[model samples]
Target: MISTHLRLSALSLAMLAATPFAHAQTQTPRQSGDGAYLLETVEVQSSADASRDGLSQPFAGGQVAEGGQVGILGTQAVMDTPYSFTSYTELLIEDQQAASVGEILLNDPAVRVARGFGNYQQVYIVRGLPVFSDDMTYNGLYGLLPRQYLSSSFIERVQVFRGANTFLKGAAPGGSGLGGAVNVVPKRAPNDPMTQLTVGGQTGGHGHAAADIARRTDDGRFGIRLNAARRSGDMAIEGESSALSMAHIGVDYRGDALRVSADLGYQDHRVDGGQPNITIDGGVPIPDAPDATKSIGQSWTYSDSEDLFGTLRAEYDFASNVTGWAAFGARTSDESSIFANPTVTNVNGDYTASRFDTAREDTVVTGETGVRVRFDTGGIDHTVSLSGSVYDLESKNAYAFGAPAFSGNIYSPAPVALAPNTVPGGNLSDPGRTIHTYFQSVALADQLKMLDERLLVTLGVRYQRLKDYNYDYNTGNRDTNFSYDEDALTPTVGILYKLTPTVSMYANYIEGLQKGARAGNTAANVGQTLDPYETKQSELGVKYDGGRLGGSVAVYRSRKPVAGQDANNIFKIVDHQKNTGLELMAYGQITPTMTVLGGISFLDADVDGDKAIGAPETQANVNLEYRVPQWQDVTFDGRVIYTSSQYADAGNQQKVDAWTRLDLGARYLVPLANGTLLTLRGRVENVTGEDYWASSGGYPNAGYLTVGAPRTLLLSATFDF
Candidate 1:
């Protein structure tokens, strides 16, 4: 089945590529008034082009975009939309030498990075809620990118949407994303021919190399791009090593009435002797962090994954003011890992760990189709959109546990003999199906413009159906008692008013939907499935765009239902967690030679009249770049990240210390006589070499500590021909 899908995707790419050339060849030269032959002008536009509905143009400093996609509503300028969003540009990705999407997101103050439970997968914390890495979307399609990690070489833009968004996109398959959503746009061929190569290395003898090549047809209607990169060797942490290889191909076509794009990508990543998360016992105090450069994981432990994914999208203009679009994407991924996360029993850091091995395979297929129309009614302008989407996933998994727990100290390490596997589930070599999920949704939205287009009002709703099935791990038999089938409706309302040419005021009320929890076997109503849970949010903000500088100030409040067993031993939705926050962001050129991008977040999270675990009160970031006046080719950049102290447990009995980090970088550009350019970049992260816990928890109600990276150096050189 996977091979058949791949063949169909390849055939579609071939047909799309052949159509533009054939159309170009059929055109003939025209005779001008002077009886001279002249070629017709061809207007070309790629997915990278900046427009109202396409990718937004970079702001004054070239680090962030002026706006980004607002779900089914397409793209809208930041000031014209009620929600808060930030689009990081490819320039920023290159300048920072970011290796993954998580690294690129470090500049966002509203976000923090954590690790998956007992594994190496990256997890993002937004507005006191978790958004799993697998939940992120690519080009507005879900479950198409690598699950554990994402390579940055083929990414063009990373867009962050704040607040509940089920009405805009759909219910996330991972059952998260109540706080925010993330969407990544893939790279596309530009207007000009290009060939570039880059080589770099970091601390601990790591080496890297990458290549990017692009070209377009003579008529400028067809374009293709290819990107590949590899990295290998030891990491900054002691005794830790990793290897990563990735490749991507992109093809696109642009015409007067139609536009199409296709992309395919592959990635293989492995990590050995990587540091593991720490879990403390309930009565034990949170221990002090160990050396930043040290690793606590066993040398025999490792994690690895391989992924293949692709997407195809097309857009057509039915008329000057009406449009329709569709997109399809699929992914197949395999992962295997051996983990030994420690549980500290005392303040002395003495811990016990046992080996746990697991394997998983995931296959995902998702697609969406929509149409939009523009018309006038009684002197008011209206833009109406209708969209439908579907997603399906099949997951196979197996696991084994070793006998006899090993002992170790956080400050001192000891090696122990490998233990024998005493318990197992399914076959590790050939796992059977364990979970199946299916989701379908239909959405409709209409935007009304009044008062000479100064006031905008948006009304939207989505009806979603969710189905999940679980199977016995050992026997591969269906478990009807643990299955669920449910449906729900999510709605949104937003209003924006332009006070002036440079300022705007906006407000919105939105909801996020998630699958309800099934009663546990110990509960009175075992196996009973409740209705879908709805997370509600309300926000108000003001935006300022001064051509060279842009900023926004917003305040929002959200409530998420919590399910648990009541006093009567009946499982039900009993309580809620309420989160309120204020965000202030500033970006763009502060002066002709200086650029700044950063923000601060203040959050108040409460559940059952206590502070929520891992939710900090204050988080802030400030990044600055300055160009040397004496040498126009020289640039210096620096950043400061600060996080306030937070509790490690729900009871607020254990607290993690506050921490700060500094990073510095410099780059120089050289121009050659042959029209080629060379760029050299050098950076130092964690310059102070501070030892601290970067984050406390990622999974719900579980506080696991992830150590911060040590001081590391990165150097790179790029040549363009």
Candidate 2:
């Protein structure tokens, strides 16, 4: 029998001991108009409005640090936005040592993690919704896909808008705007000649480096930014490790009327990791042995991937209240993998294949142009924006294997075959194909104000057309041919009433839809692109702001008027779903020396009016930091996260119990004689080392499991020049 009480690892012990002595620094405060000082630190809860230069501006929950708002990409403001939204800045990203968007989102209670094809990719589940960025829009145009295996090293900030804002973005269905969209703002010109270098070592001899240099004019008009990171080491878990390199360069010009920016970046990762699944005997969850072995049918594999992407954007303001812009972007990825199946067992009680190989190649290109016009109408300000774009994608997936099954069972251990080769006469190149999708959108919006600007009303409508074409493929020889044409007209409305200069309440109703060709029944009872997916969402929330603290709370419900579903009761292409949630978040400086960002969320998702499988009912995050004046420049941070129990399978028989985790981190700032600053930080994850499952079994009657990352420690240092 496995012991339920797991001891903390050596790494965890080190972090726990050092955390109490770390230095904490208070953030600089910038004044807001209403007798308030905005803490310039992190972007947590704030009005997400793109019109505001796309940078984080402190409002509710926490300070929207300027650096955390707009980067090389774009901006999303919470208040200026029509839906539920949040964002994180580069400083926050650095503090958490998050490697990708997926890592960052795990801190958000409302967001969930979807399976990733590779460690470098992102598979975010927001409010039970999946986010995919289609139409490569790097600087405002086309971007790359996750399968291309990109990293966040070059990203300056990340923004997310929950619910539908399709009116603001065309072809919202194909992009991250589905439940919401994530915009990675790139880095721009720095005002001063600045340079930074970071070096770190974690468990398993892991080492990492990050370097950045920037220069900008005092007037905040022109600048250049360059950043890069390289990491290599064995991962905390045995059989899991890798090496990676990434770089990003950007040049920008910004003024009262004109702004232009361009960014070029690339990332490559050589990985050797497998899915970590747990085995449960009876009602007790199994634990990994000291030698690092997991459940059967599990995977232990190695993968390598390289990604490249770049973007160019130009914007001009024709008038004081009007502006227009054009942008273009290109991205590509090459991924290859080899792996062994650990969980599989044959009828004769033998293991599965020794190894197999797979590869994916994908590319995306995008172009776009848009204009924003603002005018006064009857004492109210009205803003209207219109945009259009064209995007193309080429994706190829192929596999070759050399192994034999021990028996009829696919999961059974099998010995190597005499030769490793593609199946005889297999169409190895058949997966190579091109997909071209064209999208156009036009939006008209107006904001009406009354009662001395205390009462606000906003209304807008958008018309969109989407066309997907399968080009450059031999139709007769193709195993999969995808083509589609669809259009949608979405509407958005919102109202806000200011109880006072420091408090306000707002409500919004919006609509979302996804249209494309459908694939089901495999030609037997196939259905033509079913009616476009329709999601109607409504939210009511309030904002509160004081001199030193601010935050917001909201409850929302989004329903798909009609959906497709299967009998198993899980959400799939045919499964219909309804999701509702309540969210509360707060962030700010409780005092000159204390900063906090935290939130809690309760969610309910039903498929066909029944509880959706794997949809947890509650989740929360609480991150607190204190900067003591005595320790000047030192900070101590602690985070508490909790997730309620949820079903693991469609039948609900397999369930993942509720779990909570504690993490402690700290940073110390040391000043060098040359005015250079050295920042040292360390973190302990999963202080309790809780053994929990993340995912359940898939397909057939066989069982599978997903395990949470075990306790690990990381230490790093950064030098500023």
Candidate 3:
């Protein structure tokens, strides 16, 4: 086991790392006659915007908020930010009975959730590009959350920032996220003591039990919270079963000039006899989806994953306009799995499968430290920030594969005996070191407010150093006796102009850096490393706030360079993708008893000279909730989503049909004696039992279809005391 002391060393090194900071004092208060001052001092508190702390304040309908974490800028108001983003509060997570982060993102118009290549890892597609779960950040740090599954209960808020953010958040350690970024804010104890116990069940007799307990000192300066959940039993799929266990503890300290917080979490999840994606071959026509609940996977197929992670963060305010903060986080993950996902060879879903066993271990350490200073030069106000961060990850992996040795059909199939693993990549029981990634960056930014605070301009830059090392599976020696090292300077510029007291216009231009891709075992230049590259984005948008009603309209363009082989079978970064899109969204209370949240998005994308896969030309989502006037505690909600036809291949030869799904939900709250409250919630997805292919490919640059989920019921009751 790696020594815990080493983690602390990394944190210390990063905290002490120096980053350049710049400022110019142009404004100076002048003395006036009669001892009167010409300009009064406007102090900017170091505590940051209170709204930036968490998604505590609802914009209107309680579905989403007006602000969220914006990389190193900490939290900024949505109206004040130049980027398009949304933060889903804990209330929404509970009200919807969302099982995981993937489920909660269904309400987003610009986002789609799908399964990983051959495993159960949740993958997110934002703005026509893929953001792997591994790229997601916990708080503001990277490489901490579970790679495959992240439970909804373990997080307090889901913050989705659309557009390339490498300049703001630093390049993702996973080398992905060219489209956007996702961050989960851990729960914190509220001012009042809160304790909630919940009982839930879903279709297929799946049972769940969870608890949330929180307590704060009388002075509100010290607080702690504990949460735990367990889910098990058969799922909606026939003969399929799954189990998930999770626990989290949060502690915080709020002092006069200092704030400290710590969070610890553990998750263990497993799935057995669940259907996997089907890969098509030879430009075969896509086949109709069968019973969504039917499972053609072998009974022996199973996956197991467990992760333990924690983060400690604190901030000290030297003065009202100066604050310093440092944070450290780490994660240890382990996994073992046996998979037999099949490949479809015919138009009828007929396929061949083989056994594949794998094991993996990962250790990650991440840290960040920064100071924020606000001052005025001449008549202009500036908030200057200097920060440094480091993300270090070491991964050990092993795999054993058996060539396609069995045949089955997607419409009607039977499981066969498991084939012997003939090709052992290494010891699946205990894998050796496979890869290590060390990424470090220093950033500086200044938010300048001019025009009497009506116009805001943000200028920032990040200097990043990326290094990757690969080792042989059996022997720990370097794969090719060499390591990969590269660096880049990413810059960002954003502007927000207030057209009116309640309306604003914003635009931003940014760049994102990603590590280079490597040649696979089958490539002619296998083991060769290509140079890293960057993605670019430009956006313009306008927002309006009408008290209880709010909405925004945005247009953006982005481009990312991937990998492709040349005519000579040499791999390079010549392949690239460009996407342009428009988004219109609204969320707020339209009336005293009614609230709505929805959006429509359209995109045009191309990879090289062909259409991009997975990015539908159009998508839309709408959700409305109503509270009965006669019954104050009763509420009803419904949602509908539409996705346009999407190609199953980059060539655009095969396509998945356009599909739409509907969901309905209801909830009630009952006040009891002595500060006790009871809440009941229920939801049904795909109310009409629609069956279709939902997405093609979740892993980067791949085409695999995952069938849409069948009609599913989720019901839960919670008692808060």
Candidate 4:
């Protein structure tokens, strides 16, 4: 471990030394007429804007925002906050032609995308921990978006918060996000009236179209926006096809002291013969990855999902120094799926597969209210906030397994007869209540600024309660003995100090909370519920904003308790998994015609003196965009992603090889005689067509391999009037 740490440190130092650092032109802070400091500010049309707290302006390169939300504390400038975060803007999304939230997050070196166990839901790994898609919040409220997939047409900003954030935001309802959190901001009408249409196609006969329209009243107090899109056809992988439809409407009212906004969305998505993750059987050697374009899934398998959701938010200003806000959201979703993921039993790629079918229904309602007050005591400035939130989720589910397993070869798979479900649980058509979860929390925070606003300190705490219940899948009888009701207090402390006009240093200590697991029937303490687990993190970092070029370097350490049964067969918290890492990020223009965005992360993760499964030692990403001075309307961009080798199992005997991928894109804009604008874009992913395993192990203690996407081409055209 010592030698590995030293090696990583050396690599980080070398990269930093090779990077070009530009000196920022010093400038004095603007001041009001009353001689009070006036920090940088962005004009927000209304409190119902993208972030609800006011959308942060884009940075120098127009790819990332200058700042983003700090949970209940509201928005703060990147240089002023004592935490690490990045907000991707709509401009970047459009330029990249990203179709999903996971695609947009690829630019972050600290994040890696994976698939959920036995499903196609997108999962994110941040700092060696998994954050489920359902755990993501929409407009500060949870469980309002589609559980398995989300469309990008309605998204205006994607905010990523790094490190433990239970104190900033309440504990995620899905029991994930121990390392980080992601929040999506919905789109709203802009100041100008607009109509846009887009059409696109990809390499596998897939086609798509979308429409966006927005308008505002004469007084600019009432606004409405509508977005709709559809896509259908085969994907890059052979034998796999998908169809998706989505519609969303956003309405808002901006008043003198009261602001109100509402959004409604609907989505229907289906996939046939989707590729599945490969699981390696114990004692079997990890086989080489198969051809990227090959599909081992049975053609009879399919997954279908439909969802309807909405949110209402209002903000009122009681006074100039006091503000209050409330938000409510609800969602109803249904999913049905038949899966045939195979388990490799030998080095030659021979595998055993069985048919599994499931149906699920979910109903969720969540809300939050908060008040913020600003005041001053002597020479110290203070901002205090008090907030409360509640979330409830009821899920009904049923499943069945086929009679016998089938055998196949990974190298060459052949279609088999559709298997019949024999072993059943509950009712497949109607299902039954299997799980219910309720979460409630209240938090308080205060921020103090001293030394002429050069030094800032923040302290916060949250009291959270989690109630969970489970029922027998077949009988639908409540499992009273296994139910859990628990609570915990999570707290945070952060400090930031400005060393110069454009340089700031910050440190933070925070905790993340999650519901504990109940002992299994085989354990000596069966049916016993353990206390909630709190994951703790400590971090220190320095940031530099050069106006044109900016960057940051941070070091952090975190520990999370691991639970298991001891030799006596009593289940308990036995050990703690520790992760220490260094992250370096750089973004903004590198020259007059060149812009760069990307970063690298080095991590050392272990549990019980052994390497943690699926934790990589190094990950890096670099994206560069350049405009041709000769052809002023044309721009080109490219990106490279790299990940180091990782262990796939607890014993550290099975290792998934490291991999790298490259993507390139270009776009052109044309001005027409009718005063309309037309833009065309083209992108190529996996330019080298290298076949490899993209990720290993998304679920806890499980080792599954996700095949990398094949080389593919994407093209799109947009018209604006």
Candidate 5:
């Protein structure tokens, strides 16, 4: 283990090493304004390269070296590291009145959402890569990695980092990191006292209530925040309903000399998983079709989750003009899911009954710590960071008496309907049927600046260790354990030339890796783990600053999976997947009162693999918002999205065709008699009501799930006290 003192010493030495090159890079321009040095700023020079604001506050040593603006926990940090990334702000989410994280991501052209359990649970696809649950990162570190089947009422925003990230983060314990990672940034303590309450209902008879409370010291030195929400409603689909509750609390301290913070949360949820939705007679992909209409009436299931989490952060400024920051967090989650299968109609069409029950319990615990330091070297800058983490999980599933009647055809919608007189379900919690797993990882990185601040280079390495244990279901016997250990060295290099004070063109090369484990396998593949997977991405892009308008465009090529399963089900890491694409994003004010933010992503991710199963070959988005200058407080927002055709099933039997949709919304602010400001907002989603497919369909199950939330009208009013 590396001590904190050693970590600090190493940062100092790294800076000294970078000093020689610092003098060679030319100096960039600087801005002057209030607290300018403390506001981290980033500017994309091109699609693949970026430049950092020189006036930003100094960063800690040992932090993963970065390029452009680094977004962690909602705060922006300026770095010149080489990577393509994007950030969504809380204002953006609020403006969209997004009901869930999935809803918010619909506007991002680079992200592809995969439907799981209807639209309640989903995963993201990036640049032709599969970013599963375990591949999640928060504040630049690993957070919850379980398959999350929950809402996003409390999250503030999300950060999406594309391409290979082997050195920035460690390895994926589940061995499922085919794409990149998404970091969720929860709401932080507020800087002012506030209390907000909301009550709303949806078109589907779903209603919700939410409350938020926050307080902060005047100097921004200390703050506390609390959030709670509850909802109960019938789902958009027939015979589906849900109930959920969640709460969060956090405390934070930030000062010129030192900083510390902590956070905690818990949630309880129950939902009707509703029968698998499917279409019949080759009709539109509508819910309540023949399968759902015929199969044993829709089944009902419930899941409960109890979670506790906390994090501590400390920072110190040394006399050497260098600063060091360390952060550590721990989280634990206990979850249980109960499934009920009921007989809707007997073979003779007589209404008879049978019920089968199964339950699964999963427990996860994790701990992580990271430290970094930074200081000026002669006339250049240097930064370095080190981090380590440990994670453990245990899952158990039990089947109750009479292997619940698996007799109904999922295609028969009427046969499976079970909303009324739902068969009584039991929690088959099996203490004997379980799987235990453990993982540990360590990472170190260094970055240097030189050539009058025109060029920067970064190098990083990570080590991973994993162990798994399983218990037999039938015999109630334990199986031999599994263990794997591996290490990887990743390098990132880029160059940025100051073409002008407001424009720069740059390019970069970065590498990342993923590892997988072997479990629940046959004798032929038992005790087998696939080789570590690696991906390398190369990008060339440019960014320009037009004072009020900022935009960037990049062209990139990403390699395919390093190893994977073939038609015979054998595992290998050498089967690399490949994707080449172009992306463009623009943000800022187009006119005095008109602000526009939009982006487009075009890609061909299927060079060696099945084209139907990967990301769409092309996608685009455009959003416009304008605040009326005459009215001063009225705003209008609108957007349109489009994507190319993609595969509809794993077997590639059917292909999903290209599609598009449009949305419009508006907000008005007015003064009230009590000195409080009243805000009114409304939105008409799917203005065109164009039906489209957001994801591919599973074979056996043909036809993609349709997009377009019908025509939804949302009206809300807010009063601030």
Candidate 6:
């Protein structure tokens, strides 16, 4: 039904098409250097803050971007792209006072944040597909950033790419993000020097302080940017406290024909008295959601993690129409935690929990190289690109859990001291090697533009290989060596036709790859490593750009293989999942003083023999900002997030009712003495303090629920020097 309507809209646009012979002065929609590009026309703009590369341009809405990276194909204007994506700029991040990755994701309607399996890691669900934090890329390089928690201060932009991206980014070593990907762009030095200091506080006495400084050489040939922040205080939820610190430094050099950049960072985070997830047993009916502020986690339990990482990149132009680039990155992380998670036993909110301790260490190295060339053949413009990338990750982990179960209640939490463990996992203090994963891929693509560049077609394919290994816990000995030396070819096709200067129709077919698993020690075919499986997605969409207003409609269908155990208890990849969805999105300035941004997704998800778990049927979000016409120095903003009922059990027996949340915010800018500017911002989230289970079942073969955060009030002030 959605496709039929989309065709009608495209047909209407086609009927009003004009001649293709239009102005050649407009900038090209395509990009190079993996979405990083040189400046466009230097025409002066009226805005005080204007970026030549469009990284900070907020279309008409002043909240989201008009274009972003399309994986290996580089960046493209939103109207010309065949895929669905949204880029959130730094201006919006700071205005919302978002401190973590999870907080930043609240602006997207297509994305929902959930908790990782039995841990504090944040998980993002897009189009009913789960993408773990480990799959997030930093400046297009994987495994170089922190795996669990990352401060928003380290990032300049958040680009959300929805749909399968195997041909663009290659197979993720973590074997997640099959449906989508999030690429974080690091902060860069601005042409003008900037130094700013900020201070903030939240509902539960949480305090925050951060400083940002950036400077470019007199000739603007060399630049440096630095960011440092600290956060410590009680969280919105009762009894919970948080401590976090981070430091980041970046440097870059620009020459006539070459460019180089590097980034280094460190982060330390800890949490105490934080609320945890609850696992639901099959036989018992699911319990009602408890109060949002109730926390059962022991006061003595805590979680801590630290990470150190760096990356280097270079891009050089060999000819007027040719460019080459390379990049490399590495990360070392250490973490230890002692926490307790509860599990529901009955419908009356009865539950039980235990304390578990663990330690982990990780070393990762990732890099990529590529080349691009542009030419013309008899009036037809052609762009060809070739690239190769690799990711290697090794994890050393150990854990101990020997304490007896402690009784608890979901409605009324009872935090009790746990008996010390009698038996501890070998050397939990110094974890041993546990897992090693490696991935590599090579991709080639060609874009053909004909009919005065009104029609664009792109074809590409990637050859990918994966190798995963597992070792015995505490001991460095290899237990199951899953040496999958096999490789797969994933192809992609995309087409875009410009019916007019402001309207376009596009379609894309792409494939996704996931690492196949090996037989466990108890399986009949133990140690048998299987070849990687593939998933496919086909999408059709149309976009319209009205200068100050924009919108898009997309319909897609995808199928992916699911891993499970057979009746004989043998592990294997046997079944497939089919997902069909319709998405409608809108953004930009609806008027001179008011702007709107939002989208809605309707999904139909089904497994081979059962219903898909954890995914809701309908999800939507809307954000609005209006400037006070009378009080020109003040602005008002509001946002609402809604999710329909979702199944928490595979059989679809337990379900959650649809819920909606409202957030309100305001900002005032004042001109101070000495040409200085001061800004005051305040926000209230979850104004009603609603009690609900926000999400469920991120991990495979289990249905666990995570509670929503309590009502929160945030206030902050910034001084520009």
The candidate with the higher TM-score, 2 or 3, is 3
Give the Å error, residue 110, model 3. 0.5
User: Tens digits of per-residue lDDT for model 4 on 128-242?
Assistant: 8888999999987888889888889888889989899999989998888998999998887765556789999998998999998887776667778899999999999898899
lDDT of each: 0.86, 0.59, 0.82, 0.85, 0.54, 0.79
Residues 242-264 of candidate 5 have per-residue lDDT tens digits of 77788877666655456555666
- In model 4, the runs with Cα more than 4 Å from the true position are 1-47, 50-53
Model 5 accuracy (lDDT, Cα) = 0.54
**Candidate 6 off by > 4 Å:** 1-56, 481-483, 520-523, 567-570
lDDT of 2 by residue, 1-721 (tens): 1112213222222221111111112223343564222333321211111223534443322323322321111353344333566666656666777777766766677766544322223445566665553321343443553443446676655665566556555554353444555666676533335678889987667789998787655444566778899999876655567788988888776555666777778788876665433223333332222122222222345677788877777778788877787778777887776654433232232323434566667777777777777787777766666666666666665666655532222222223333355442222445455455566666666666667777777777777777665543333243334567777788888888888876778899887666643545644335445455667788999876675676688888887643334465322355546788888877677876787777888888776555555567888988887765666456788888887876644445556677788888998876555645577899988777776555333211223445566677889987775
Q: Of models 5 and 6, which has the larger TM-score?
A: 6
lDDT per residue for candidate 1 within 333-408, as digits (tens), equals: 9999888889999999999999999999999999999999999999899999999999999999999999899999
Clash pairs of candidate 6?
A: none
Clashes of 5: 66
C-alpha TM-score for every candidate: 0.93, 0.81, 0.91, 0.93, 0.77, 0.91
lDDT of 6 by residue, 1-721 (tens): 0011112111111111110101112222222354222223322211111111224345765567778767677766887677888888777788789898778887777788887888888888888888788788887888887777789996777888889999988887777787788888778766556677899999889999999888766666677889999999988888789999999998877676777889999999998988887887776766667888757677877889899999998878799889888989999999988878888888988878788888999999899999889999998898898999999989999888847878878788766876676456557778888888888899999988999889999899999988777777756777646556678999999999999999999999998888787777787777777678788999999998899999889999999887666888677877888889998988888887788888898888888656688888899989898877776557899999999888788788887667889999998876566634577999999988888788887776567888887889999998865
lDDT of 3 by residue, 1-721 (tens): 1111112121111111110001111112333453222333222112211212433355776678667789888888888899999888776788789989998888889999987889878888898888889889988889999999899986777988888999899999887788889999888765445678999999999999999887667655677879999999998888689999999998877677778888999999999987787788858988887789888788999989999999998888888999889999999999999988878888877898888889999999999999999999999999999999999999999999976489989888786887888788878888998999999999999999999899999999999999988888887788663478889999999999999989999999999788878876666787787777788899999998887999899999988887878787777876678999999988889997898888999999888677788888998999998888776567899999999999889888988899999999998876556635678889999999998888988777688888888899999998876
The runs of at least 3 residues in candidate 2 whose Cα sits more than 4 Å from the true structure, single-residue gaps closed, are 1-54, 58-77, 117-120, 133-142, 145-150, 172-177, 217-220, 276-300, 339-356, 401-431, 434-436, 469-481, 516-519, 522-524, 561-575, 695-705
Give me the candidate number with maximum lDDT. Answer: 1
| Ranking of all predicted structures according to lDDT, beginning with the best and ending with the worst | 1, 4, 3, 6, 2, 5
